[model samples]
Structures are given as C-alpha cells and as structure tokens.
Target: MTPQQFLQQKLQSRQYAGSYRKLQVQNNLIDFCSNDYLGFARSLELSEMINAELQNYPTILNGSTGSRLLAGNTIYAEDLEKLIAGFHDAQACLLFNSGYDANLGLLSSLPQRGDTVIHDELAHASIIDGIRLSHAKRHSFLHNNLHNLEQKLKAAHGNCYVVVESVYSMDGDFAPLTAIAQLVKQYNAVLIVDEAHALGVFNKGLVNQLQLQSAVFARIITFGKALGCHGAVVVGSNDLRQYLINFARSFIYTTAAPIHQLASIKMGYHLLAQSQLIIDELQIKIELYKSLMGDVPQSSKSSGAVQTLIIGGNQPTKHLASNLQQAGFDVRPILSPTVAEGTERLRICLHAHNSTEEITQLTNVIKINLHVK
Candidate 1:
C-alpha cells in the first residue's frame, strides 16, 4: 500500500473509535480548561513586568541565534539558570526549550546501556518517550503503588532510576513522594521527579514543599503550567548538569529559548515568590469545586487545579464536554487513549482567576447534565 493509503487507514480507525484528535482555538468563555492554574497566562501585570525587565538587557536579541553550546549562550541565560537553581534550592540548573526536551535529554542520556528505568504507569508521555530513546532496561510499576514500585526496584538491573510526576497531569493527584523516596533510598535507586504540574500549585513544588529536595536525584520543572510562561529547567547537582551539558543530544542540538521567554520566566518566578494570596485563592477555588461536586458519581475528587468527571465512553465524554462548552464553560474531554477506555472523562481545570460563581455554575451544569445522562 502507498503511504497515503496506510495513513488514511489509521486515521479512519481513530475516527471510527471516536479517538480522532484535532486542533481547536478556544473561544472566550468561562475557562474550566487550561493549565494556567494561577491565571498567570492572562495577567496584564505580568506582561508589563516582563516588558519593564527587558529594558535592563537592551542588547538581548528577540531570538536565541543558536544552540546554547554555540551562539545561544548568554550571560542572561546563565544567570537565569543560577536564579532557578537558587529558587529550587538545588546545586545547579540547566534550561531546556520545553519540559519535553528536558525529560528527553536527561532520561535518554543519563541511564547507560546496563542501567534500568522504572517509571509509574501514569507518568507523562514525555517520560515514556525519553525512556524509549534510552538504551536502558525499562519497567512500569502500577500508578502510585509503593509495593509494586518496591518489586520493580528489587528486580532492577544496573543503575536504577525511579521516575514519577509530583502531581499527575490527568488525575491531578500527588505521588506518594515521602514513602517513595524512602523506598528508593532503601533500594539505592536514583529518584527523578517531574514537577511539571506541581510548580506553582505547591508553591515551589511537592518535592521542595516536603523538603525532599535532598533525597531526589533530579527534578524537571516547567514554566508553561502555573507560571504562565514557557520553557523548563532540570534541577540537580552540579555534576548532573555538567554531564547533561556534555552528553544530552536534545540539549546539544536545539536552539536556545529567546531572551524574551527567559525574561518572562524570570518575572514569573518573581511574581510567584510574592503571590501567596493568589495561591490561597486557587486553593479556595479548588475547595469550592470539591464542596459543590460533593461525591457526585461522575466526579473524581482532586485537591489541585485539575478535576475530572468520568463519562465512561469517548463519545459520551466528548458530548458532555461539548454541552459544557455550549453553556459557556470551556471544559474538554479526556478520551479513551488519553485515559483508560472505560474512564473517559471531562478534565476541568480551576484557576485562581475563576470566581466562586463560575465554579458553582460549572458544577451545577455538570450535575444537571449528568443526571440527564
């Protein structure tokens, strides 16, 4: 068969299964979907701050002209890494254009041919892709299950690496970090926590929140989520940073992020450091959502910004998401392949900017529609 015929067949299969994906532009509606949990993406004040800060570095170009190893390296970029390291209280930091690159670079390079990578089954796609690129033996433990993790750790060969997300993106639940850390310590495994979803939610992150920074071997933090910006950073020891710089293909080949993006990240950190009230506001919204949801059969309880209502089929979940959107709430569905087949859900994200009325209305709409279903 020709390539077009083969591609069409696969696309047809996805469409028939109700799992076909598409790009969409969001309409102006009550945002019940988006990773801007702190509402930083929409902050006019932050934009102003970033613009003001850019004046300090007048010569910085609009784009990073080359990779960091070549022409992309700047005094500002190096200083920004240092600032990020200090914030996370890590010995060193290395920037990546995005969280995907950071994970891909770190995982694909760190574990040698004889090493092992054991990750949680629910870990993000970036983690899986990074592991796939590596030459190491890989295993997946049951999601958040300590017993299963210990079993994998015991069976691990070579240098063992344990990976998990601090706050799972889809479920919005936290990993059993302290327990997992202790187990990793007992088994002499290196712990790598991706703090992509946990950064602004838990202040710095769950690892830093729990004071387990010392226990973790490395951390991947992203700015696109709650920080309302772009790019990511890997926080670890000076040695690990140096090793990635020398050996990671992703880091070596990619163009560096523009100076403006770095400036936005720097200002985001500045705002986050002083925005405890804003953080508290987000918590209040979460609490309000949970209280209103109140053990609804469809709703899955989550303390963080991400919450879900299982619809059990891709078509049904998508239908419900459409209904919510029609009612002026911008909620979206988690389809079969993105989640489990029987657990297709509407993933609702609550932001700090979301008013109490919006949360109430959104929950009421969900409950009413669920009852109708």
Candidate 2:
C-alpha cells in the first residue's frame, strides 16, 4: 500500500479520536506552546546582528553542500565549536544538525558493547532513541529518584554512562545534578547530560554553573530551544570530539547544516552572552506561570522552561488545549504515545517574550478549561 493509505489504515483510530496531529499554522496567539524559551527567534535585535555579521562575508554560501567529513567543513563551524567549548568550559565541541541527531550519534557511537547506560525513565524521546541505538546494557531509574538511580548504579560494574537532561523538556524540571554527580563518581561512571533546554538559559546549564564539567563525560547543548536558532553541540574532551567526528554516522552521512545556519548559531551564542534581558524576561514569565498556577494540585512540580499539567487522558487533554486556544492561549496537549497514557498533559512553554499578563491570563484559562474538561 502507498504511504498515505498505510497511514490511513494504521493511524485512523488516532485521527478519529481527535488525537491525530497535523500542523496547525497559527500566529498572534499568546504562545505557551513553542520551545523558543528565550524568544530569540523573534528578536529583531539578534536578527539585525546576524544581518550585520553576514556583511563580513557578503557571498557566504546559503547551504553547507556536504557532510562535515567532506566538503561541509568550514572555518566558521570550527570557530563556533571553539566558542561553544570555551563558553561551556569543555576541551572541545562538535556540532550536530539538531539535538536529536547529536544524541543519536553520541549514544549510538560512544558506549561500547560491554558498557552500561543508566538513564532517567522520563528522558526525552531523542535520548531514549539514542540509548536504543546503543550497544550497552541499559537501565532506567525513576524520574528524579536519586535512590533509584543509585541502586541501579551500585548493581552495575562496567564502563557506565549516566544519562540525564539538565532541564527535562516535558516537566520543566531539573535533574538532581549534585547527587547524580556524586553517585556517578562513586561508581566511577561517566555522566552525560543533555543541556538542550538549558542552553542560553539557567546560566548556561547546571553542568557549567555547578562546575560539573570535571564530573561529566559530555554535554549536549542545543541551539534550538533558548538560543532560538537551530543545531546542537556535543561538548567534551578533544578525544571525544574527534571520536564523534570519525564515528558518529549522523554526522558522517548527513549534509552539513548550512553556513547561514551556522552563522545564525554563532550569532545566537554571542547575543546570549551580550544580553541578560531575555533571560530576565523568562524568569519573570516563569514566576508568573508559577504564580498563576497557585493552589493547583501539582503546581509544585513545575521545572525548567516548560510547565506541564498532567491531565490524565488524551481526549480531555486535547479538549483542554482546544479550549485554551479558543480562549486565546496557544497551549498544546502532550498525548499518548508521546507520553504514557495516564501522564498525558498540557505542555505549556514559557518564553522570554511572554508577558506577565499573558502568562496569568493563559494559565487561568488553562486551569478553568482543564478543571471543567
């Protein structure tokens, strides 16, 4: 059968249930939906800066024509890597097309067959997919449960890698970094932290701020979320960087990200360094989201830049989202099988550009609609 026919047959139940997702192109809504955490994507200040940087190379190629191993390698890409490495205090850095590819490449290639990878159960899908692609014996600990993570660690004796996100994407929560670092240290295991949601936010992630670089084997910091650009970087030792350059198939096989995209990433990095306004705005919005969510049953569970309300069912979650949208809030439903069946939620993303008024109004809309639904 054709792809369309196959999808129609296999996924029709989802479509009929109001859970099938097609891209909804709407603008001008009070956005609590996108991962543009710091609102740099819509920042004209950064846009003008990027345009100015382009002036230095007027004929800068539009796209990177090939993979980094081939003709895609460029001076600016290497420069960006150095800047990233220095910013995060890593010995080196390697760029990937996106956070997903970076995780896939790192997890699939880095861990040896005899190694073990213990990860958090609630990790993002990219991390889970990457671990599946790995050859290591894998185990999962309960979300944010240090004791559970330690129990798994104590039972393992191998070249282990503890995988976690600095800031979890869905729940907007932070990893127990200090405790995890201590456990990994006791086990003599390498720690891999995906700082995808923390980059250009959280003072450049817990790894950088808490001085966990010496304890961490690698960090995956992506530009998509807070930097509001595209692409990701794996930051670690020069050897790890070189190894990925040689063995990471995602980097090896794919066309390199375009020069303009790299330029944008570079520009985004510098903009993050120069400005604290976006960071401040986001903190304000986060506070607003928290304040608005007051007296809600699970309000204390909020973390990172995402505020998730676990509504427990796909149909109701989608209904609540639709209601919020109708009420002028652009919130999205996180449904199964994206999350497990009962953990379905409204994934509200707070942004630097989101005003206190917008946050308060939207969250109130969410509470009213979700409670009713």
Q: Evaluated with lDDT, which candidate comes out highest?
A: 1
lDDT of 1 by residue, 3-59 (tens): 999999999999999999999996898988899999999999899999999998888
List clashing residue pairs in candidate 1: none
Q: How well does each candidate superpose onto the true structure, as a TM-score?
A: 0.99, 0.95
The TM-score, computed over Cα atoms with residue i paired to residue i, of candidate 1 is 0.99
Deviation from truth (RMSD, Å), model 2: 2.0
Write model 2 residue lDDT over 21-139, tens digit each, in one string: 77878677788888888888988988998888888998877788889888899998898899989988889999999999999999999887888989999898888888889788889
* Model 2 CA lDDT for position 356: 73
Return the top candidate by TM-score: 1
RMSD of 1: 1.1
Error of 1 at 289 (Å): 0.4
